[model samples]
Target: MNLTSSIRSAFTPQGALRASINLGNPILACRDADGAARGVSVDLATRFAALLGVELELVVVDAAGKSVDVVVSEQADIGFFAIDPLRGEHIAFTAAYVLIEGCYLVRDDSSLRANEEVDAAAHRVVVGKGSAYDLYLTRTLQQARIVRSPTSPTVVDTFIEQGADVAAGVRQQLEADAHRIGGLRLLGERFMVIGQAMGTPKSRGEDAAAFLAQFIEEMKASGFVDEALARHGIEGASVAPAA
Candidate 1:
């Protein structure tokens, strides 16, 4: 895609493409041994900056909500996030480049054997504050009470600490936590499928949004996203279909 002046200005008014990198989602991004951001999202942001012919300034944060805030407040040129209607009000999202499953976890002794058993008045569910699953469950789970953890990576810890009945988050994350912490098991089925996408502030205008959407489609078609996932050793997530 040609980097038109208007698209350039929309994406980099500050003379650099400030990409918000959320380390909270391990599948998308994480801190390396040296604490530098690295993962599929970081790779995508780097390539997008190269496409725009601008310097890339990563505005790294520890949580998904902070990433969304940086983009919606125009502090960053673009960010990666799960597609949600609430977030869409302030940010114009591109078509999803990856799809991830949202699953629930419980102590091994817990009676909740299936995903359908999670919603009950007696159940207190723990979730990453302002995460995709949090937003999703808040609207869908009619009876269960939600307890918010500081971030997605902390969901399992928070769940155990608070003695909550259920923990919710990305499947890969929950699985790793279950293996690390032990004595925890995931429900038989996923509760939701999160569509992870790139987004810019809505005020950036349609041209910028259109360009991002096109960029995602091209990346998916060219196998950039799939390659990034494989390069990062990401599991349990798939490249989204062309939009």
Candidate 2:
């Protein structure tokens, strides 16, 4: 069957992406003031569904914790999240689409620099609880005392407001942070490069993995991904076929 047909038969009358997935999301999917799912996640999910000629059923998580319980519990077929190898053991990822660096976020008046110096015991670092950065900090910076916030915005805000020595998130997010939280500056070069990929249920079956891989490849070849990021004012981004 064609891709369209695959989508049609992929679920029952409920139109699930997979058998166990129950659609919902606060940011990605939501019952608007009138109860409707909307946001950047919605747009991406919609586009992917249209690309495959399928109906998208969103699955909402607590928007806290791992924030991917929908996919992890087999309640959803895929999820969009930052790519990390630590997560790779549990889930399959699409190709590296967007690049993010875990950088230090500090107050403009602060004497610290982003990624300028090694993390030491005296420097307190704040990151979202259960975030990829949290895992990185726990594993890499054994000496630094790590503090956890419940969300990305909170960490950025707290860091700017003098809640911690630094905060961590993508550079693109930092651009937004400068406007929303003020008095904050992104510090240092990237600590590590993280890619934005789709989370598919991990499996020995290459079908899902292969689809994600090809989706990323075609997006790069067509320039659609680049155009999308550029339109959003995100710069210095590129996509090239693997050598």
Which candidate number has the best lDDT? Answer: 1
- Note the residue pairs that clash in candidate 1: none
Alpha-carbon RMSD, each predicted model:
0.7, 4.5
Off by over 4 Å in 1: none
lDDT of 2 by residue, 2-100 (tens): 343543443213455531111221122334576555443445566666766667776654333445665666667777666666777777877776565
lDDT of 1 by residue, 19-75 (tens): 999999999999889989999999999999999999999999988998999988899
